[model samples]
Target: MKIQVLSSLALVLALLSQGCVSSKKYKDLEASYTQLQEKSRELNQKYQSGQQDLSGSSSRVKSLEEQIASEKANVAALQAALDKCLNSSSQGNVNISKLVDEINTSNKYIQHLVNTKNKSDSLNVVLTNNLTRSLSREEMRDVDVQVLKGVVYISLSDNMLYKSGSYEISDVAGQTLAKIAKIIKDYQGYDVLIEGNTDNVPISQTNIRNNWDLSALRASSVVQALQNTYSVDPKRLTAGGRGEYNPVAGNDSEAGKMKNRRTQIIITPKLDQFMDLIGKAPEKATKAE
Candidate 1:
């Protein structure tokens, strides 16, 4: 009976040992499952962050492309404007060069004309001196002649030319006028300008109202006399009156007033070169053949 009790106790101890082993295995499996769940949560979070980063990068790339396109358009517009400016500047420079050349040519022509005028003026002075030397002493005393500023100036006092405030020429003045007309006719291609001057005096006659009328009438009379007697071309002659103006001396004394009452006959060469320089020559008129 004692032997049977011992065997029963040994069987109970073996069963308790098997229960402890089973409990230990179950605890280990629960710990491993918890660690695996934490690892899965961390991996999910990393994947979401990567997706956000990729979305931000795409947006930045789109913005950069838009900026680049805008810059490219601006650059093209600027380039076209620059090209236009360059072309206009080049054309302007060419026009300036052409204008400079024309101006230079015109200046050269003007200089040549001025030199010729000087030479002509010198010759006229010599001719006037010769004429004065050849004149009789009485004639020289009656009439005064001088060359000034490339023009011949003659002074005929009231006693020589006309009575007080009279427009009629005296016999002596007529002879002098004839001599001057002969000289003018001999000088071809010369323009004649007759200017009448009067002193500051009032005149109220039946035929003359004021100094201007008297002066104008006197100039006109001289012009008519030259045209009728010498056959001077009307186109080559000009007459003007400067009454009480352009006085040579002050009108304060009798001598000064006498000096102021005078007529001037000016002769000048045709201004061909000067007119050409200033582009005043008439353009060729188109005539039908």
Candidate 2:
């Protein structure tokens, strides 16, 4: 518009120089030129202002775009964290379930062990009672019946079980052995151990070399009598001897020597039963993953 205005002013000036118009027309044309110039100045001012406003608007748009990108990144990071938390919660629930199962299994195994111990104790108590009830008052004077740690021990004096200073079985001992054999036969699952203990006195018998030999022979003799004479199972019997080592009393006096010379019949459940119970136990629990 400025260029068009300047071209029109130049045309008017050239016409005036040639006197193509009167003074009044030239004056009118000059007035139009002045108004056009003023309008051009106003348009230039508005254009400058618009350029400044456009530059500021572009900067604001760039800043807003950057802010939007940053917000998107923050949202992505939060989503990742949420997903990780959800996965961890699921794993934790599974671990808790496994731990509960392990605890339940352990409790069941412990209860089974407790029940087995109770049954063993009951059996031992019944065996002890039967032996005590079967013995006469005179026989009880030389016999001792006891239950220790789920095993039955019936101790008989050496004088009552064997001939004096010898490993031979006495005639009077047959009745007591028969009664004991009957009780042992009743418990088919139990094993009997005949253990002989002698006083510190040395033996001078023909075949016996020392107290160890005497004590061992005494235990063997009793074991043979139970097996052969009374029909007791030899497989259920084990004979052992303590020369003077397992004495119940000191052998310093005759009374202490008499107390120390004795035979013990120990009755217990078969070892295989206990081993089977142990073998059937559950495996150890693993830590939950």
Candidate 3:
């Protein structure tokens, strides 16, 4: 009976040992499961953070693309402006060159006219014939005339037009002026300048003060005769006076003084083309004298 009780105690001890081992194993499994759950939470947090970072990166990339397109458009606009500037500059140069050529051609024509006057002896007979036929009978008179630099200058001496220091136009001079007006009217494009020259002798008349006044009045009187009597265009006419300043001969001799007292009517070709050329050239500032 004592042997049987010992065996039963041994069996109970074995069973108790197995139960303790099973409890220890279950605690170990629970700890392992908690660790796995913690690892899963960390992974999920990392994935969400990564998604946020990727979204921010995508927005930055789109903004950079827009900026690049804007810059390209700006570059294209600048290039177009540059091209337009170049074309305008080139056209301007071409226009300037063409204008210069026109001026050169006009200058040559003017020079030809000047050279024709230098051979006046051969041309005088023809010119006088033309003038006599073109003018009225009363305008025919023996007057001293000169041709220089394409200009026909008739010296209406004091004896022909007025008494000494007088501003009155003589009866004969009036007839001659009428004829000249008719000829000038026929030539529409000619630019006319009436210049009066006076002797060196000073005058103190009531109507006139000095040589300047006398010269100016004479020029004005002639211009008025052309304008009022002949109906010449005012725009095509200019009047100037040289008071003993532009003398033809020395003032010492009586004959020289007589030659110096004169009036000149200058006629020239239109200079519109020449003036256009001058305007197109670069501006040169002139200092005050």
| Winning model by TM-score | 2
Error of 2 at 269 (Å): 0.0
Candidate 3 has an lDDT of: 0.61
Cα lDDT tens digits, model 1, 1-289, are: 3344445445445656677546565555445555656666667656754564454345534544554465455545555554565567555666655544444444444444345445765556555655554455566555666554445665656567666668877667777777777777777666888888899988779888888888878888788888987688777788888888889999999988888898777776656733543453212111100
How do all models score by TM-score? 0.55, 0.63, 0.49
Model 3 misplaced regions, further than 4 Å: 1-129, 132-142, 273-289
For residue 111, give model 1's deviation from the true position in Å.
Answer: 5.4
- After superposing candidate 1 on the true structure, give the runs of residues whose Cα lies further than 4 Å from its correct spot: 1-114, 271-274, 277-289
Better of 2 and 3 by lDDT: 2
lDDT of 2 by residue, 134-212 (tens): 8776787888776655577889998899988889999999999998999999899999999989899888878899989
Q: Comparing 2 and 3 by TM-score, which wins?
A: 2
Query: Which of the numbered candidates is closest to the native, going by highest lDDT?
Result: 2
Poorest stretch of ten by lDDT in candidate 1: 280-289
A best-first ranking of the candidates according to their TM-score comes to: 2, 1, 3
| Cα lDDT, all candidates | 0.64, 0.78, 0.61
Clashes of 3: 0
